[model samples]
Target chain A: MLKNIQEWVMVFLIIGAIILIGNWVGYDILPTAAIPGILTLIAICLLGLIIHRLLPFKLPSIAYIGILGFVLTIPGVPGSTYIVQWTNEVTLLAITTPILAYAGISIGGSWADFAKLGWKTIVVGMCVLIGTFMGSAIIAEIVLRFQGII
Target chain B: MAQQLQRLWKDWRLHTLVLAIVLLTEMIGTHEVSIGPGLILLLPMLYAVIIGIALFFTPLVNEKQTKHAEQLVFLSVTLLIAKFGVQAGPALPKLIAAGPALLLQEFGNLGTIFLALPVAILLGLKRETIGMTHSIGREANIALISDKYGFASPEGRGVMAMYIFGTVFGAIFMGLISGFLSSVTPMHPLSFAMATGIGSGSMAAAGLGPLVAAFPDMSEEIIAFSGASNLASTVTGLYMSIFIALPLTEKMYGWFRGKKDKNPTKIPSRNQRRCYKLC
Candidate 1:
């Protein structure tokens, strides 16, 4: 658990540096201004991980992290205003660029394995990916329209 | 802890390449190229992945670097989700107001099996169809299949294949498709946002990018809705997989394959690890 905490903190710091630069270049948000926001995001994320590790039962660490973020930034909560204000400076796009980059970088290693799966597998894989997203979107649209929410 | 820190430091080459990719792509910024009725919206993250794939095949990158890149995505994506969660916090009222739609949208995830299962069978897939078409073949789905059928089985092979395929292409395809769909379909951007929560981190981010780009006015709401729906999916997905997705796919697979016996096997308790990767 401790090792994972260390690893995640280190990776976040690395990615955080990359994100700070991306924020500055892309959004014109200076790194000096975004540093506290990035740190708060990092600290809350690690706290969520630590909380999940300490829990007796099993649940995804994402559940914990998402909940922590939601709780920490909600209104009337102590420090919630500052939490929201600080994290507000970090552009969402800046954070996701490296993630998709890693996603892309990892693809070639699996290209060999992917080729072994055959054409039928390719067709089915695309189907599931499309179905998963389009299906949900179609349903959400229908339900939201039905509920008069959209 | 010190030893693990040393191991983390060894991925420097991977991080440097990723940093370079991010900076260059951001410098190029957002673009939209129209084809027919739809547009292929190209964002920085989209280019980052494309360039990364292009670079990976070249001798400039190595196998070990690729492995570390994959590991780093799983480790670091939590931060992205953290950002989304924080963004969604104050907009809690919007998420709560549209609560039923958010909850109902989860059942939309089953559309994977509904749409993919018949096609998978028609394309001549066998029992493997059950594993591949079920739940987009993410880390949890892999564990469920491995627990029930063992990784050595045909079903295990099916899930693993789909997992690799999703990891490789799901982000790029999803980003493109979501962008295209948002532009051409005329559905509200929020609908596309809910759809983005289909249980993968990088893919969800990819899908959300273009919508927020096209509809800058609703960018905050779009980001918040995607974040909330994604959190909803993560919380409910495991139970939904076991009780609904897995079994339903199995039943449908039998019917689609024209098999007589309905009862094949019972499910085992799934052994899940910290896996956010479709790979």
Candidate 2:
């Protein structure tokens, strides 16, 4: 019954797509918005199907990571000189992002595996981060020098 | 509780030390001004990549530990992006106006899941595992409620609702408090309130964006002052939600459970642990 419903939905969708395409063609709006939206939708569908096929089914952790990155970016708000404000933004990002990321990972994986990683993980993690930052600084300096922007 | 607190402290301590050292270096050092923003964004990404390299080198680095570090770095990158976008590009209103289209464009990603589920069902996937793997009903419920009840159901929606709620209440309360305090002090009530409210997340952004946009002529220090005040509120909201909300919700559940008549038939037969496990 559900399969039939699914087929019907797909058919309806195809019909709708044809109508939309026909209208766009009739209106000579082919190269403008319709093409991009349709193309983007097709790409997303293909990617989704490919991902479903390749991976053992799991939620996308990357999207949540992107969201975390989004939240962290909040503090970099321009033209603020308050030390407290700066720290607060950094602090919120520091604390909340990890919790959220962990929650996401746990949701995507086994809860049992997540619970085992203790405070030691965070310490080692920071050490790795320091190294990362140092390497980044060098690369950024080189890039800036090359671009003559620095 | 103690263990969790200790973990938070350890992580935060390291984060604080790094930020302090790096920020101080940037301020005190005679670094060229032109490459500042690029450098800022590059730092967190570099940190993530380097950490990835370190994980590869150290065979002893467990999977979870690597994930924990990655999460932190991810957060840092997120913070940088949001800040940079606001500073260099169009502000919040413009960004939000773009949000709905982005969401709509991504609807295929959502719809494809529904497609996979019924297929999996046809394949005679294990009932228990299938139940654990999909959350269409839960998602539908959340979407429905968010549209209807809006931000009232705390856990029903994710951070979006909380952001909206916090912004609304934070602005009203902070405005009043700042007004009262400013009467006796030199501080601008709006700025003070804004600074106090910023850390809580939504309110700080909404409040600060509008205030800054409104008073473009205001000194950076004044804006900073508002942001600074909001810092504490944001932190308090973050920490309190974890420590307070969880326990309070648990207690509320217990109280409701205790008050319930002993009607065994009324209890849900569906396994909640199994249900939530999928999400």
Considering every candidate listed, which one attains the maximal TM-score?
A: 1
Task: Put down candidate 2 lDDT per residue, A1-150, tens digits, no spaces.
Answer: 344334323422332243233323323344334433333322323333334345684433222222232343344544233322332222122222222222222222223432443333222222222222222223323433454433
lDDT of 1 by residue, B6-118 (tens): 56646888889888998899999999999789998999999998899898878878887787787778767888889888888888888888888889989999999988889
Instruction: List candidate 1 segments past 4 Å from native.
Output: A1-7, B1-5, B259-279
Give a tens-digit lDDT track for model 2, residues B216-241: 46423333333333322322333333
lDDT of 2 at B25: 25
Displacement of residue B27 (Cα, Å) in model 2 is: 25
TM-scores for all candidates: the values are 0.91, 0.25
* Docking level for model 2: incorrect
Against the true structure, what is every candidate's RMSD? 5.4, 25.9
| Regions of model 2 farther than 4 Å from truth | A1-150, B1-81, B84-100, B103-109, B128-279
Fnat for candidate 2 (0 to 1): 0.01
Tell me the TM-score for chain B of model 1.
Answer: 0.89
TM-score of chain A of each: 0.90, 0.31
